[model samples]
Target chain A: MRLFHGQRAWVLQRLTALVVLLLLALTAATLLIGPAPSYERWHALATSAPGAVLIVIFFAALCGHAWVGVRDIVLDYIQPTALRLPLLALIAFILIAITLRVTLTMATHFTVGA
Target chain B: MPAPPRAAPKFLNLAQIRFPIGAIASIGHRISGVLLLISLPFLVLALERSLRSEADYAALGTWLNSPWRALLLVVMVWAATHHLLAGVRHMLMDIGIGSRLAQARMSAWSTIVAALLIALLAAMRWLS
Candidate 1:
């Protein structure tokens, strides 16, 4: 069985990387030019439609990009397939948890006051 | 007929290997990726806390104002900037750009410089 065909994953990694790059640039610019890091400013930004959308997209892309990168490292260093597979699974689980937490928090917070 | 067994050669010491700037940058890319992965949990917690309530957000702000947090932020910023620049270089290489040895080396150095500069800026912003 072919367990690790990485062409698709490679393409997705690059694509998601591109998206993340753009989003990060926007975020950095906002941080530099907008108000300081305070509760009001953060809440305002996170509750906005564009900000919410961007946050969701960024986190999702981040999860994909990170998974591909960490999986490659694991494949390169870990010789034992058993160990590598479980480790990869763990990474995936953690990323999923992060995505869920961020998304849910944003959703609940944004919708409550709107 | 049985094939002849291969003889094992002497193991080379890691210290003997000379890493060029490009190789160093490549290794830094991997290291930065690992650093960001490890820091993700903290980042997520910070985000959650900031969004939880006004008091939690103020607490996060206070925590971020601390010297220890400043140091952690610097390291994280450096990791993120380095990872980003290296990722762009990798993307360029994927597109058949900067594939030459000299060009690759130049880009790698540029990535390091750019990352450092960004991290310095972030440090200044965080401290002030």
Candidate 2:
């Protein structure tokens, strides 16, 4: 048998969820241990590859998950499929744009001064 | 009499539940969404506090375990589980795991059970 329900979207959601959980665990651990890291320490941590990867993956997954959820909400209550579809599209566009923007900001940390 | 018109029923057939598993799931998901919406500000404030200083962080730690905090935590727990369960349902639909009526019913029940178990644990943690 397949390891999962075998749908691509479902698998993607679960995979994203697993990534989110792992990231959240790391976040909780870091916070619970201490919140007094110096600005340089925190900045270094954020600029690290593992941190960047975690953050990018997190934003990506969060956008996808929230888009799916909001789309479902539209479907359930919008009453008109035509309207629902466009609303979902708009939401997807906005989420994707914002995520890309944030990712770009994260990318700036390692760059040499302009 | 040629015709008779009576008052329309005030309640939806949905309000009358013979078998309400699907409706229950839908309701739970919506409720979770609403709870998450309400709790977002509190959580954000907590997040902001924890980022400010050690004392602020300690305050958040204490706040997270308070009675109102526990209630909000339960809401978040419900939201997380409901959303997760709904995601699994979508996944199952895609994989053809439970297209049959019986199997779908079983899956729905499983979601509820799993959600309840998670909620119980989260509540316990909050209380403890």
Top candidate when judged by lDDT against the true structure: 1
Question: Which residue pairs in candidate 1 collide?
Answer: none
Off by over 4 Å in 1: A112-114, B1-7, B121-128
What lDDT does candidate 2 reach at residue A110? Answer: 43
- True interface contacts reproduced, per candidate: 1.00, 0.00
Q: Which digits, one per residue and each the tens of the lDDT, describe model 1 over residues B7-61? A: 7477788789998999889888999999998998788788778777899988876
Give the DockQ-based CAPRI class for model 1: high
**TM-score to native of every candidate shown:** 0.88, 0.60
Tens digit per residue, CA lDDT, model 1, A27-114:
8888757567667777888877777778888888888899999989998899898798889899999999989888887787665343
Q: Candidate 2 at A55: error in angstroms?
A: 2.4
- Individual DockQ of the candidates? 0.85, 0.11
DockQ-derived CAPRI band for the predicted complex in model 2: incorrect
Best by DockQ: 1
Off by over 4 Å in 2: A1-47, A79-114, B1-12, B17-19, B37-57
